[model samples]
Target chain A: MSSALVYALTGAALFVLGMAGLILQPHLLRKILAFNIMGSGIFLMLVGVAQRAGTPDPVPQAMVLTGIVVAIAATALALALARQLLDMNGEMRLPEEKTGKDRLDV
Target chain B: MRTLLNVTVLFLASAFGLALGWLILDLPVAAVRLPEQVTAQLEMSGVVHPVTAVLLNFRGYDTLLEIAVLLLALLGILALPRHVSDHQHRPSSANPVLQTLTRVLAPLMLLVAGYVLWAGAHRPGGAFQAGAVLAGAGVLLHLAGLLPAWATPGRTLRAGLAVGLLVFIAVAVALMAQGTLLQYPLSWAGALILMIEASLTLSLGLILAGLYLVLTDSGVQK
Candidate 1:
């Protein structure tokens, strides 16, 4: 097994872990963390793919670098929204039940 | 119904994982042969490897743009409301021991960050990594209450945020006037890379500081 393959497998494991966390965690902050973990996994996979070609592909590395910056920007915005939501609700926890009345209120 | 949804999501995820796994497994075997076109280009360029040339010169545009994105993020953060008062602000939980430790470690962190920036010319260490380290020092100070959140971002801070983008954009435009975008005139690659790396280090550090301040919602003063 090559080192690239190891990197890919590691990335896949991280992605699965992040996906599970996203599904199971109710807190917005934890969900954000899971999303970031998933993103890191994807970026790692991209880097692994880039390494597959004989010569290094600056293209994929560059794209992944761009993606990292964009991901952080989006995460920052999402965090700001989460902060606002917490300010209104007094709790960071997401409500589990959504009744008809809740839908109407929203 | 919820269980069904969960199972479906899992199945799809597994399929995706398997595809990636296959790609990884095939990569080594496929990589053993070089494409004719790539070999031809290598011969023409007289440069054994083109990746380095492309990264530092040919596609330098991408790198410059990446730095710009970071600069824009800093600007956006600065434009945001300084404090969101409604959110509960956590008080400092600094202990004397931690404060003493951070005071000693701060200088060491700064030294390491400088080393990383200098090492970026031909190695793995680069502006982003160095800036993150430097910002870690600032975070430590903030946690120690040595620096307050609202302490004026200081002139140095503002300059740091803008330097990367300004230098990159200026250089790129100058190159464009010479008939190609981001092309460095002969033998200047090292100098250009160093300048870009230095500015990027400052910009990245400022961005990290801004992010910490935004997340903590603390006034800038210590």
Candidate 2:
């Protein structure tokens, strides 16, 4: 009924959509976009929760601000890795030779 | 099976939503009033409301940390090898109409960004939103070939990227020496917010522009 609840529900839906994109899309860039979408959703949810007391909670707001910066940093690192991978191989596809297990070992 | 999964998740989510809606349906609206601690602080400070106070003073440490993270990102991007083989050039075309449009839009966009930065103290507009707009303008310029794509980012770009973090950190250190981690002792809250917003806008714009360049140069077309 409240606007905060509406925002929370919207955020949850966005998070689910983003998660689905992350899982189904194999492209690294798409994955990054999906991850950013998910981050935005979480930020929205936190802000919504902060609105519960009829005033914004500075703690969650501040945390989300920090989260946004960290998300961008992680994204930049991922982009760099993706670029290196592309350079090594002409194809943009993830290497079929290395399984998830191999990546974990490294 | 996929349909079944979708239906199941939707049903469960709806059920939860219904339960939550019912639980809060009868609660007195006044019960949700903002906490006294926030209001008391606002009253005692004789300044703006809780949100502004909290952002600039109460939890300012978090903001400073966020700026540091942004700075780290710029540093990381700068550290990346800035050598792209000239053999891999993509033929870019220039259009006079588009160039003219961009030239006109750039100044207007910059003005809007400034307005957004100034209005952020008590509104929805802020550093992030304004910076995004400014970056959009930069992207347009880049597309129009007004800006060169150097493998090495220029000194001005680097300075713009670091200014927000440096300013924020300097202010935080000053505040720490005065006792509080980021408290604006003299109650120059408006001035402090403006300073942070301006620096943040510049830093964010540069970061976005840098990211755009990296993404475009990566040649990962969708």
Candidate 3:
């Protein structure tokens, strides 16, 4: 019922959703988005915990800020890798096992 | 097998989610967030905003490494094969209204970025927010045809991109003579922090804009 509790639960849900997306999705971009979602969930949890004292604590908030920046940097790097994979194979996902596809076809 | 994997992952995720819910429900909302010493030492941090103080003063080393990480990402992107890095962008001309809006708003964003940089001393604004605004301006200019599709970052741009890290390292090293790393003389803490933030703002803007431009291209420009 409290705002902090609400945010904390939202963060938990987001983490679960993001993890599900990461595990189930095949597309590289979707994986990246899911990873970012997980990062956001962690950040949200940090901020939520920081806010438990009614006034937010500065240290955790500052850590979250640093984390957000780092997450963006990692996302940029991951995206570039995705683009490279696309250029080489013309597919975002690796060859599907169901198709019995091999590296040559990929 | 794939369906089984999916089901297992789902089950695990749900279990984790339940644990988190229970943790949240039991969390103590009332506690002393900061110790007496941390609150007592706040004045020497040279910023009234506690978050800013923690970021720039107490945990500055983390920020320095973070900027380095950003630069590493830029390097990684640039290191990609030429085919991937070199791509065509959108057409030179955009809708007239959009172009007009960009032209009107970009400069205002720059001004706002400056204000954010200055206001970080006392409020919520800081280098990251200001840098993001500047990046927004660059993206706008890119959309408006001010930045050409084939535009390679010039020397000044490259230098600007690295200036923040260089400044941070240099200052940190210089301060080693006085005492601890990144420890500004208490009297000079505010000014040094501002200088570092200013350089960081410029570099972060260019680095982000570079990534945006590279990733958003639609066609081969050359």
Cα TM-score per model: 0.78, 0.75, 0.90
Superposed model 3: Cα runs more than 4 Å off: A95-106, B27-32, B35-38, B84-89, B149-151, B218-221
lDDT of 3 by residue, B108-176 (tens): 999999999999999999999999999889888888776653235568888998999999999999999
Model number with the top DockQ:
3
- DockQ each: 0.30, 0.25, 0.57
lDDT of 3 by residue, A1-106 (tens): 6586678788889998899888777777888999999989888887886675466677888899989888988898898788778888878875652353333221
Candidate 2, residue A57: the lDDT equals: 66
Tens-place lDDT digits, model 1, residues B22-104: 76676544433323444454433222334433444556777677767765665565565554564455455557888899889
Candidate 2: misplaced stretches above 4 Å? A20-25, A52-66, A90-106, B1-36, B43-52, B83-93, B218-222
**Which candidate has the top score in TM-score?**
3
TM-score of chain B of each: 0.77, 0.73, 0.89
Proportion of native contacts found in each model? 0.20, 0.25, 0.76
Where does model 1 sit among the CAPRI classes?
A: acceptable
Q: Give the distance in Å from residue B7's predicted Cα in candidate 1 to where it truly belongs.
A: 2.4
The TM-score between candidate 2 and the true structure equals 0.75
